[model samples]
Target: MSRAWMSGRLFGAGVIGAAVVGAGLIVPGSALAATTCAAPPGAPAELTRVQDAEACGSTTDGTGGAWSLGAGGVGFADAVDGATVAAAGFDGGAGAGESRAGRLLAVGYGADSLALGMLDEPGIAVIVTGPASQAFVGDADDPVLCEGNLAAAFNLTAGSGCVLAGAFRYVTPSPL
Candidate 1:
């Protein structure tokens, strides 16, 4: 559908753009008409995990919000079983505005499934910046985060290591 590709490194770990596209997580430049809210005035007008899920009637936890990604922004989205599930965007340049850390909640699907996906980028660790007890299982579907590779997720948590959010499967050992 006329996808515009990007090629670069993220967090100095793995390559961006191509990995997510190859994984078929998102169709770049696809219409986000499903989202009820207007795109933020950031560099790249796109939706995030919370926004798409909520707008498309996937979840209603009301965790959707926007963060300033200054310039050279990149966005990613995920769908499971033909339903739009999650999305996120990152600013490639110096970001603007306050940090939205701890604001976005790591939502899970029915029971065993989560609304997250792997970007197919090796060495790019998905760091969960929520409570200390917060943890996740990667694409390998490993029961623990240590055993599997840390898959990339959407993160609006500014000043954090990666812009992509973390947690494919929530594995909290304690209360948040």
Candidate 2:
């Protein structure tokens, strides 16, 4: 696997990308060599707390079918354990086209167990436009997005999809 790695923003993984599509969250473009996967460096400063448990978001599929769903979570991970994928539309089954804000769900190492956290954010646009098997995560099992670069860097990793996703440290309380 020959993955392209720039520098600086190689960290964590989100919920959407290449093969898996991050639960079901569609990007709105095709896949290719994404050169914009690196997002600045640090997480946002103005972080917000998730008021409710429901995820609010809108999605437009390839067929142009726009849909919305609340309380979108199927197999969401527990923040108490570790960082989890908080993505919308990623949650498959039932509602079909919706999921919890896997992008906004992140648990710190300890203490603030249920509070939202900020990790090194990756470029969703990159994963969205990069590969079908790539997505982003906040900091799951020691970073998945950046892990791709490492694996691909050493030609030791291969997946049908990759992710450049991560929960925003600066959440807006609810999904859009």
Candidate 3:
């Protein structure tokens, strides 16, 4: 699987498999859902919406756990492991530090997952807001992000409905 990622075979775990089908990106018919970015607990009320959408760049790295498009900080981590650390805190402390506000945005599934299996289950999660370069994961073809799919969870639309990409840090963890 790691080789596949290096060869550009997979993306955003599995939710994203975009290709230049013509001049447009190939978005899976059943994969995308509009999600809502509500104010997470402990977050100041002024931040009603904290983030926006962005495109993923070249696949510089690959772990392979595959993050649900809707998953948020520490939201999907509980699904894989019973524990989590905030990812938003790269201010100084990094790497498993509890101070950072982060979540499990992606995981290894192929060779990378196989490698991770030898020891601990490795997962990567980004924060709720940031520049596109740091906020997205995937090649430029399709950037997998947690915010783009928030409409459903918040019911931002009339009746689009929410799809469980993973868990919402602002809320509790729920399966998709």
User: How much is 112 displaced in model 2, in angstroms?
Assistant: 21
**By TM-score: ranked, best first:** 1, 2, 3
Model 3 spans > 4 angstroms off: 1-3, 8-86, 89-121, 130-176
- What is the C-alpha lDDT profile of model 1 across 1-176, one tens digit per residue? 22322222242234234333433342224333323222332233343333422322122122323322111222233222212223322212111111111222122211122223332212222322121122332322222232122232332111122222334443334222
Q: Model 1 off-target regions past 4 Å?
A: 1-14, 23-33, 39-176
lDDT string, candidate 3, 1-176, tens digits: 48855443233322222111210221223223322222233322211122233111111012222122221211121122231322211111111111121223222111111000011233332222211111222221222333322211111111111222235423223324
Q: Which candidate gets the maximum TM-score versus the true structure?
A: 1
Clashing pairs in 1: 48-87, 49-87, 153-164, 153-165, 154-164, 154-165, 155-164, 155-165
Ranking by lDDT: 1, 2, 3
Q: Give the clash count for model 2.
A: 38
Best model number under lDDT: 1
* Higher-TM-score candidate of 1 and 2: 1
Per residue, candidate 2 scores C-alpha lDDT tens digits across 1-176 of 23454221233232222224432343223212111111111331111122233332323222122222222221122111121222222222111111122223211111111111223322121122212222233322223232211111100111122322232112112112
TM-score of 3: 0.17
